[model samples]
Target: MADFVDREAIRHCLARLARGEDRRDAGLIRAAWWPDATFDYGVYSGDFAAYLDWVVPGAEAISNTQHVLGQSYIELAGDSAKAETHVISYHRVDMGAGDRDTCIGGRYLDTMARRDGEWRIADRVMLYDWYQDWGAAIDWAEGVMGYPFTAGHFPGRARGDFSATFFAAGQ
Candidate 1:
């Protein structure tokens, strides 16, 4: 039962971190990590604060992002745990020409610590498995298969995104 609880808490932390990136929510992202937590993503290696400074702006610059988490393999030991989570992330960006869709498949190797009864990441390392660059993003204006998206509510990369309201309303 304790293992199950710890695993669920760690998984939830991962989910929150992913959503934080997708929504460009710095505070949410910060909550997932310890102040001294470290990260290495090949391109950058730093503590949590530096990681936030680098990541938040990058997320803001991108038109959109969606992180799809597949599965997490966790090993628990007392108050600490190790987790490797599979992920596929999509990004829409302007490549100095037009909006392009890109995706990368990766895994997040994490060292998690349960402190003050809350589980948070103590360190993280991201490993890339594959990458694909799709030249152009589909025109959402044309909609999917020519059927328009429901008019008023569109997804956005900010705290005021539709999901926020949905969650705020206790749904």
Candidate 2:
């Protein structure tokens, strides 16, 4: 049905937004929002452009990051919809002494609108559920603490890392 299609499109848009952050791709992140879209993330409240400006560089500086999606509840009306998506974001920051792990659980409450048959977020409010942080010491040269003999086959999170190449080839 048309409603099912709309819901899937909305889900795809949200997933792309998360992928953009994980890959540190500004363009992909920008595509998820309309030019005048608004966002409130507790720590920052601003327009989509401002949100991208603030988030891009900050995400790029992190050693590694992942946004794990839990569940999404969407209510659809003719050309408008409201959605709440649960997320758990994990970040590893490398300091001089050691790496630190930061984990946050939150919900993205979004107002979406279809313009020219394309759906994008019109406004988003992020609600925090919980958060935690701890020091994560590891020997990257040999892998994690107990897995000393493991091999690092996966690529880094940087733009041109091997993962990108692998994904491109698969596509």
Candidate 3:
């Protein structure tokens, strides 16, 4: 039972981190890490606060992002745990030329610890598996296959998005 609880908490933390990135919510991202946690993703390496500062703005610059998390392999030892989580991240950005869609497959190697009855990541190293640029983004205003999707049917923004409002009300 204790193992199950630990695993559940760790997985929730991972998901929360992903959602925070997609939403560009600093508070949500901060919740997933310990006060002194560290992070390294090749481009940046530093304490968690520094990482948060760098990541949130970077996310905001992008038009949109979606992180799809796959299977996670976790090894538990007392209050410390190690987890490798597979992820496929999709991003829509204007890379100098124009807006484009890109996908990156990677894994997050996380060192997690339970402190004060809360599970959070103590350190993380991101490993890249592959990357692909799918060229320019399509015109969503044209609608898909003659089916129009306007109004509330749109991608979530970094802030003031439908999902953010929905989740906020629930809390």
Best by TM-score: 1
lDDT of each: 0.88, 0.83, 0.88
Score candidate 3 by lDDT. Answer: 0.88
Global CA lDDT computed for model 2: 0.83
Error of 3 at 60 (Å): 5.8
* TM of each candidate vs. truth: 0.92, 0.87, 0.91
The true-versus-predicted C-alpha distance at residue 84 of model 3, in Å, is 0.3
lDDT of 1 by residue, 89-133 (tens): 999988877788999999999999999999999999999999999
User: What lDDT tens digits, residue by residue, belong to model 2 across residues 115-147?
Assistant: 999889999999999998866734456545445
> Per-residue lDDT of 1-171 in model 3, one digit per residue for the tens?
989989999999999999998877889899999989999998789998898887787753378889999999999999999999999999998888878999999999999999999999999999999999999987677666777767644645622478766768988
> How many backbone clashes are present in model 3?
0
Q: What's the C-alpha lDDT at position 128 in model 1?
A: 99
* Cα RMSD of predicted structure 2: 2.5
Model 2 CA deviation exceeding 4 Å by range? 59-61, 94-97, 148-161
